[model samples]
Target: MGSQELEEEELVQMVRDFIESESPSSPSFSSSQGLGTFNQQPNYLTLQEILGSVEDTEDEVHQKILKYLRNKNTAWKTTNLKKWLVMRLRMDGYDASLCRTSWVTTYNCPGGDYEYIDIMMDNDENGGVGRLIIDIDFKSQFELARPTTSYAQLTDTLPCIFVGCETKLNKIISILCTAAKQSLKESGLHVPPWRGTNYMQSKWLSDHCQKVQPIPRISSNNS
Candidate 1:
């Protein structure tokens, strides 16, 4: 495997290690509780609640990140959004050198094309530098030529995608869903019926990532 692919594998291994270490070995039950009874589900904060919490944070860096993301116009541009995200990641304790924007990697597509990753992060400490590619969608309307690669081609190429994110502001989830379905047609993957659900899009993108070749991280030392 190339350096980039090796890096990604290392990241996956690290995640597996973390999960394994944190997971409980066995379920613990109390004799006093009835057998039929179950533990109450933990209350999770909703998206709005999480955003509200960030907005109300006393930390300067947290507030700055939230303010930057809340800027509607700035968030619409992929370049601007990437810069802000990289900054936020740095503030959140990620290695700045590992996070890159406008990362270019050549793929042997139909006519030989280049894939520009909006934001790529290589969190692995190994010698390899395979990054996790993240694609951001901010367009309010879906265009036929939205992606440089066609839906038919994406079935063959999009598997390298690590994450696909859409802006919460002024975004129509239905339009995004339509685009996703078109891309998955040739890949033999199916989009969930609930197009509006975030989980559906995440699952689809993740599935695509699993199918494509791993995109290697560009060497920073090489100009």
Candidate 2:
């Protein structure tokens, strides 16, 4: 079994917590609506409204925002590791003013602490490097990109993210995997693909995925 290493910067772990809290309550999920003014309604805030109050935000918030944006209009259906990452957030920062002007109407992108994240892309779909001002995304428990492999020649190091639950990043990874497999299948390469599992994930694919590879994380206890 691969041993989990302790993190150096303690804040890295805390960012995960913050992202999750962002979407603490689902918009459609509401208490029982009965006779007179019966239960409370789920609080659904617009993306711009969310960014406005970013003096502080929970990690869940980031998760929700990403999730919403991704599935919002199927725009995220074809994102790559390089494009759909936090880099996307950086690009959106360029039009902070325009975004604010468009806020009441078309400001759908989630807010970021732009002072820390540098905007270099001309569009939100573009990707590049940006400074991480604050460790304000994804929780440690729900951390994305567990180290798996190292590409350097000087030293040997272990890498690979753990597959346990429905971390937003994992779900995003799965979406990429699904997209890749779909492409391979279209090319007739997935006819006899290696089997994966649905072992131990926090969130899983919908019921429609009939012939998915058994990613050990979501399948058996062979870990």
Candidate 3:
């Protein structure tokens, strides 16, 4: 066999390994259950449940973000918006900061990086630390080129701005990835590896994430 043939063989084995690894670990509503027994909820109910489950601090931070967006200047870019939000949250006495995660390419997945806002808070009851994730365009992450009615409805239930804990994010990613694979199959399209649940989870759940405070840009005229 030629060198090209060897490379092809290695790539094929990598994909097979990825498939095997994803099987038994796929998440569901509960850790002990599987997606087979999962029930789909109506869009409104799903959103309501997600929004209602947040802690008081998370809900307050989410509302602040919404109001910030409503009064945002059209000229502000996404990066600026995040910086401003982080600054505002810190001023308001929240431990909010910008977080970015990057992963290297593996045989079964491509390398990529993602940035989002995270707030660290001390749990009052347990006296433990908790982290709340805030993704500005959370819904758009799972969008497909073409989708079945059911898949579209499922994605519609995702919040535009995701404000939840790690556990909640994990459950949502699992549900969406399962639906996405089905939707692609029904549309006669191949499901890409990046759309896998593992890949989605890596964006936020990876231990390699870097957190930092964004400095507010000073006007040149101020000098």
Q: Judging by TM-score against the true structure, name the best candidate.
A: 3
- The digit string of per-residue lDDT tens for model 3 on 1-223 reads 6785564455334423433443333321111222221335454245336545666676677666655555554414333456567876676667788999989888877788888889888888899999989876676799999998778766655556677799888878877888889899999999999999878988998777998845643333211
Off by over 4 Å in 2: 1-76, 79-82, 94-223
Residue 141 alpha-carbon offset, candidate 3, angstroms: 0.3
lDDT of 1 by residue, 74-102 (tens): 44333333444554444554332222212
Descending-lDDT candidate ranking: 3, 1, 2
Q: Write down the lDDT of every candidate, Cα atoms only.
A: 0.32, 0.25, 0.68
Error of 3 at 60 (Å): 1.1
Worst 10 residues of 1 by lDDT: 26-35
Q: What is the TM-score of each candidate against the true structure?
A: 0.23, 0.19, 0.72
Deviation in angstroms for 185 in model 2?
A: 45
Clash counts for the predictions, in order: 4, 34, 0
The pairs that clash in candidate 1 are 4-130, 159-208, 159-209, 159-212
Candidate 3 minimal-lDDT segment of 10 residues: 28-37
Highest lDDT model number: 3
What is the C-alpha lDDT profile of model 2 across 100-173, one tens digit per residue?
01111113222221111111222234464321112122222222122211111000110011111223223334
